[model samples]
Target chain A: MKPSSPLGARFRTAVLTLSLAVVATLGSVSRADVPVREEPQRPSAFGATEDAPLPTVAPGDLQGLLRNCDAERERAVAAQKLCEQDKTGVDFLGAAYAALWIILMAFFALVAIRQRRLSAELATLRERLARLGER
Target chain B: MSASSPDADLQPARPGVTWMPYVVAAALLVALFLVFFVAPRERTMGEVQRIFYFHVASAFAALIGWVGCAVASLAYLFLSARQGMEVIAKITDRLAHALGEIGVLFGTIVLITGPLWAKPVWKTYWTWEPRLVLMMLTQFLFIGYLVLRAYAKKDVAGRKLAAGIAVIGGPAVYLIHVAVELWGGNHPQVVSGQGGGLQHPDMQLTFAVAIASVLLFAASLVHLRMRHHAFTDELEDAYLELSDREDARS
Candidate 1:
């Protein structure tokens, strides 16, 4: 079948392209394991610095560090601070609400515009029919 | 207008000029109040879990819209070919189209809001889980229906074909409803046959309110859309009438 109009054909093509883009993006991102959240402002306690010198640790000292877990406890304390500092969850929540409101309002506006246009078109058609009937 | 003219049955009814809008507005406000202030923060996800109230509610509303579209489309298909049933057939046709459009709208909300909620909770915006895939498929189907309705010829055959699309897309909704149970995806099964997803009383109450409000709002949208369809049909009929008169005079 033919397209209703040139504009309709263009609109359909655009919609199809956008849908494909969305599907491709989703497919590519679904495989990613990394969390989408941004890292906290404070640097993490863990991860070796490229410029830092590696200290040679004695076996006894290594064993003591492993058994006492002093470094692990400090990392945990730092992790708690990092978790508290990160506001990604709250930001996402706000974004979700905003998206919802935006979509709903846009739909309402679309309906309003369609109604106004249709009313005007209908009145025009009826007036033309009245003029024809009078002759 | 003569009884035989297409415009004879095209009188516009102002469905939106009713109490439905006030009720929907009040219900939405109450639901928002319940979701934010009354519902307690979840232990694990904290405040972000609040999105669950509307996310799930939108899914419910979308399903209703799709299922209702299917039913209306079936009626239109059955009635369109019968004699002297043109008015009822037109009504069903308009209803089907309205529901189909509304389904797409709500399904879009589900798709958008789902990812937003998932980004932090699942640590990803989207996953190829069974339920998620099914929901996405449903959205595509309804979107196709709307596109077809918009571009197809304004004739009985075109309407029937559009109705067929809706009818075929109907079963996908049921499959989406059961996808979590069948495939055990990352998507949570909040309301199920076994029942136990929502544990808190406040959560359950907020969810109920949200579902009611969203569903009411969707139904009102469908009603308003049907009125628009009627006006469009009336305009077409007027054009036809004017064209016929001009031909006679010439």
Candidate 2:
């Protein structure tokens, strides 16, 4: 197995595995929930102060460009922030799905293996009967 | 398969001139060597890309196994119509089950090694990429196949039910390749993110060797399973022949 994954993968697995382990271990260790601090919500760009362009605009297409430059910059910044959030959201969901499956399957396999010998005995009896029918 | 007695010549790890599994083992070794020593390390992903050999190889091997199941299932359905069936029916049936099991086994390796390989590259266990989804679906269907095999009685109706499900196997294989292509179209910059239209020449060569070695391995598996099936069938035939002679004497 390749041990070192790329940055995006490391971030997701680390985040998810860490989150799951923390939740599982902490809840088992102590009853109290860790209080997560929330960041103050920033005002949307529509509510932000409008910044103006410098005084070097000529009478050509330059004047029109400068006029909406601040609004466009605000929109681009907002869009980029949304992209980062969307990326994280995708990682979160993917990690959760994978982790849940791995954890649950590992749990099931660990538990089921103990009963495998019983199943083998049943199989032997069935095989015996099939051989008996041939007689 | 040869003139020699199968009971003496055909068992795995037999002393002297047994070559099947050793050939398989040698092929695996060379495949591993080329992947590790010869193939240039990925500029972006480094050594972790080495897992690519086993991952893709197992995938192809699993495909071959699935195809065997599909063909055997089809033949079985047709043969059940005739009476006085020969060893072909029983042997094919046993082979179908063998290939199906091997498919699942290799698919498990692909799935497990996949996440490990993906982690270093995609930095995540999985994404909602169409390719990933189809692979999971394929694995689940194989699991269904195994379950059907496990429960089905050695009777007419049981075989029909298993055969019916096995019919869908072929289409599902086609869908997986198509799904990977379509998924790549939608998510251009995600996972493996290499260009060359997803078929880099170096990557293709490694994969080709991977396919070849894996096929050789699969052939070895099928041959061995066939031998086992045939030997056991021979013993049954021997017992029947003995009983017939006893009846004649009576």
Candidate 3:
């Protein structure tokens, strides 16, 4: 049989293409499987605009307005803190993933090295035995 | 013990090409992609929750591998008792050793990843959590098994001793599984009990993929390790035969 027959080459190309297509489909399917969580609506910080005209304040309304301003400031501070915590959490997650990959790869490399060394030793021993038999 | 013995040239040669490793690597890569890209970031724990996919999967693999080792060891002991040092018993012994070593490898990953995941979510690197302590003990037991096998005399006595230890330590896996429930720790039981575990479809899919990937990878490693051990045994037999023949000539 020819090593690189055109029929075999074509079959390999077709299989490769089919596999890529299947993988792409699986990726899309997984992405679509993500459940949409119903998050509670919050006021956006970016929604506050400088161009919006301020309403004329009466003497009684001025106190309520000042309280509202203080409340908004507190919410903004809380949001900032939450964002910082999320960032820190992401950083820790990244570090954990890095550590996992490094450890797994290191273990695999060690096993491969041991396997290679054993193979070489076995070969040498076999050669020695064969020479003894010849003698 | 002679060059002309029937068993002298009877050892099977290793295959020239093996595709299992490539399959395992590809599965792992797909699982990784699904974990990081497809799975949604958790609401409460944020990105840190993603670690659960691989962490839990590794733990499952390690636990299963150790249990497999124990079962194989028990089978070896049983066979040896009945058949008296047969080829099948030796094969089972080699299998037990391979599984034990693979268990240790994955168990080490679990120990490291567990701490890494814990530090971010639990706010501490190490906790004396019930499950954590039990897992550590189980890993230590298997590590001791591997150490004993490595340093012990290469004879039937050593094999029996190692097999005995494995049989004794096999129950630790069950204890580790229930430790959290019994002691009431923070470890979440996702796959068992009422309202257990993942709510999202993507999370479940990713976890399933991860578990399958690790299991297949562990199986491949065990297969390869067993082949190597078989080769080692064949070499030892050859050496013994050569030595015996030399003694006769001298």
Candidate 4:
């Protein structure tokens, strides 16, 4: 059987490349169709009138506020210690991702090794057949 | 034909390009970077939500492989039934087997990652959720097909039986997809329904890239596996011919 002319081969390659480009463009366009939904803003922690000017504090009131701050800091420290005791140090996210990549890489390595072994076996088989033929 | 038959060497085995594997490897590496670095972290789930990228992408790839296996199995069965194991039928058989194996590999990844993601979010390693159950069933069904292919005798009858199993197993994928809708479950509908799908554009972009990369990787695996299968078939044929010549000499 005769092979195709060089002109025909070039034309086929051109058509194949064009088709691939068109398909890629269409895929990207289709994926981009899903619009991202924007989230609504929540009110500030200071309340709705967060921009209002602060009222002047009495000297006596300031002293009380400082005492409250000291007590709150001591309580917060105790709460943090309790929380830390319950918290597990293991990072599940990192572990999950690591497990996934390990599985994939192992499979890839297995295939590569299998291919190499098969090629080597094939070479050995060919040599044995050649020796048999010589006899 | 005998071992010394000229036609054995006359058949051309097309040489595969050297660069295709490198291209796939690079694409997958880029996808990994995009998944970890580029995609926006979910507000509620935080860092653990990153698992969703590859988990969903692998599910997509596995589904594609199973569906491809079903189609190829049908083609092989139809062609072999009519034409008695012709080249096209044999090629389809090889494709079906390769796709089934690749699908199982990806499916195993899905099952493993599901539990890893679930343990932190759901406070348990496993659940009897509808989608989970259905996905498990689907994985088991195809796995049964693989077991049959591996353990069964190397003959047309074995191939036919395995092909039939693949045909029956293909619809399990559809059932798994609809299982969540059919029964109320704990599984999050991130890709469908109202309210809480992907909110960030970067998440969407990363998901797309991940899916494309996984699909490209799957295609490369199937191609390489098919080539391996073809070479094995050729080697087996050559061995049989040589054995026949030895017997004739004896």
Number of the predicted model whose DockQ against the real structure is largest? 1
Best-to-worst lDDT order: 1, 3, 4, 2
Residues A29-62, candidate 3, lDDT per residue (tens digit)? 5666443323322111111111223345677797
Score candidate 1 by lDDT: 0.76
Q: On a 0 to 100 scale, what is the lDDT of residue A86 in model 2?
A: 42
Give candidate 2 misplaced runs (Cα > 4 Å).
Answer: A1-135, B1-17, B84-86, B185-205, B231-250
Model 4, span B1-250: residue lDDT tens = 2445623452322337678788888988888898778885554444666788889999998898998998898898899988456889989988999999899889989989888877666666666667787777677767766666654424677678789989987788887787777886667777765555666677778888889988988898888788777876776677677777768776
Alpha-carbon runs more than 4 Å astray in model 1: A1-86, B1-13, B193-195
Better of 1 and 3 by TM-score: 1
**I-RMSD for candidate 2:** 17.4
Which candidate tops lDDT?
Answer: 1
Candidate 3 lDDT over residue span B71-180, tens digit each: 99999999998855687898999999999988888888888877776665566666556787788777777876776676443567667877888887789898888886
* C-alpha-based local distance difference test score of model 2: 0.57
DockQ of each: 0.15, 0.03, 0.10, 0.09
Candidate 4's TM-score? 0.73
TM-score of every prediction relative to native: 0.79, 0.55, 0.75, 0.73
Docking class of 4: incorrect
Indicate which candidate wins on TM-score.
1
- lDDT for residue B78 in candidate 3, whole number 0-100: 92
Q: Which pairs in model 4 have colliding backbones?
A: none
> Least lDDT summed over 10 consecutive residues: which range in candidate 2 chain A?
A40-49
Best-to-worst ranking by DockQ: 1, 3, 4, 2
